[model samples]
Target: MERAGFWSRLWALLLDGLMITIPLNLIWFMYQGEWTNNITQGWAWDIVYAAYMTILPVIWNGYVIGKRVLTIQIRKEGDQPVGLLQMFIREIIGKLFLGIATFGIASIISAFMIAFREDKRAIHDKLARTYVKNRI
Candidate 1:
């Protein structure tokens, strides 16, 4: 299987942020009649979106909504399906916490790794022992 490109993966994530996260946050704002303190996170919809990202691929054969749209998939090494704990490590621990803890340096390194690595695996992918593959 071919690896997904960095640009495609970046675009897919942007699409998810725009198409899903933003809209859901907007709906929550409308219902609450007030903006959230953070606006982008620390809200119910953010948690829901995080859960969606972390959980959907495990059960949905590696495709989240944006990944599905972009024809890419997250999989473990050897092209096996990802699992719950691995997804949790990838999305929550490796990406979120480490990204935050490192002052975004890890995120920048991940971008480079995804762009430069032959397998297109990011730091989070390495941490979780997973990678994104191009389905097209």
Candidate 2:
């Protein structure tokens, strides 16, 4: 498997944002009986989004919506597919909490790391012992 480049990872993330938000907003509308930017209103939305990120790959053989669309996948250094604990570490602990603790600086640096590093791993991937690579 070849490592995914920065641009593919970046585009997958943008697609993932749309893949997550639209359904979340629709569910918010269903539950709240209205649509008023509810997906951005609270921490619950964040948890839901994080859950979406954390859970899907484990169940889908390293495919969440955007990664599937982009033909990339998350896997360990040994090329094994990620599991739930790894995904939780990668998404919740590594990305969200660490990003918050560092005031987004870690995330900014992670982007650069992905762009420049030969392995294309960000902080979260390193934390989870994971990497993104081309599907083929």
Candidate 3:
């Protein structure tokens, strides 16, 4: 299986960001009964982001909405199913933990790793021992 290239993965990320944002925005609207307040000021957005990353791949065969559209999927190093533990490490530890504590600096480093590293493994994938593979 071919490894997914950085640009393709980046596009997939953008798409997934949009997908996550839309529903989150709606939830904010319904909760606050307004559309202008900042949702990032609290833990709601963070929780949503964590759940989106962790839960989706576990239930969807490693294919989040963007990965599904981009013909890419996350897998164990040897093409195994992504375990819940792996998902938790990747999503919660690698993304949410670093994102919160570092104010996204660590996530930025992960982006650079994806852009320049030979295997295109981000910090999350490295921590989880996973890879994103092109489906076709």
Candidate 4:
């Protein structure tokens, strides 16, 4: 399979974020009957949402709904199935840093670097020893 391009991978990420966010927000609102404006609560929700986003692909062989739709799957550097520990580290550490930038500036820069790197890896991908590839 061909390596997935940066734009394609980015689109998949955005799609995944939306897929996770909409439902999570809906559930949060349903439970609370209004949008919760508390920063602490928001942060708590972020933690929950992050876990939801991270755990699924890690456990499911890297084919989250967005990735499945985009015909992309994440694998280890050698194209093997990504291990749980690697996924945990990637999600908790790498993704958390990407999220800290809010508008994905960090992710964009990382993607650009990945595009030129010998290994074809984004920052998160590098840190986790993972790569997103087109599904055959």
Which tens-of-lDDT digit does each residue in 1-136 have in candidate 1? 7999899999889887777757766786899987654656566655777788899999899988789999999998888999999999999999888988999999999999999999899999999999999887
Model 4, 1-136: lDDT tens digits are: 5878777777887897777667766777898887643522557767875676577777888877788899988898777987777777677767776658556776667778767776567777778888888886
In candidate 3, how many Å is residue 88 off? 0.4
The alpha-carbon lDDT assigned to residue 112 of candidate 1 equals 97
What's the count of clashing pairs in each model shown? 0, 0, 0, 0
Task: Report how far residue 25 has shifted in candidate 2, in Å.
Answer: 2.0
Deviation (Å) of 110 in candidate 1: 0.2
Candidate 1 — which residues are off by over 4 angstroms?
34-38, 43-46
Candidate order by TM-score, decreasing, is 2, 1, 3, 4
Model 4's alpha-carbon lDDT is: 0.75
Give the alpha carbon lDDT tens digit for every residue of 1-136 in model 2.
Answer: 5899899998998999888788877887898888766575579878878998999999999988889999999997799989999999999999999999999999999999999998899999999999999986
Task: Single out the weakest 10-residue window by summed lDDT for candidate 2.
Answer: 33-42
Question: What TM-score, over all chains together, does every model reach?
Answer: 0.88, 0.92, 0.87, 0.78
Q: By lDDT, is 2 or 3 better?
A: 2
In candidate 2, position 24 carries an lDDT of: 75
The most accurate candidate by lDDT is 2
**lDDT score, candidate 1:** 0.87
lDDT of 4 at 67: 85
Error of 2 at 105 (Å): 0.3
Ten-residue stretch with the least lDDT total in model 3: 36-45
How many residue pairs of model 2 clash at the backbone? Answer: 0
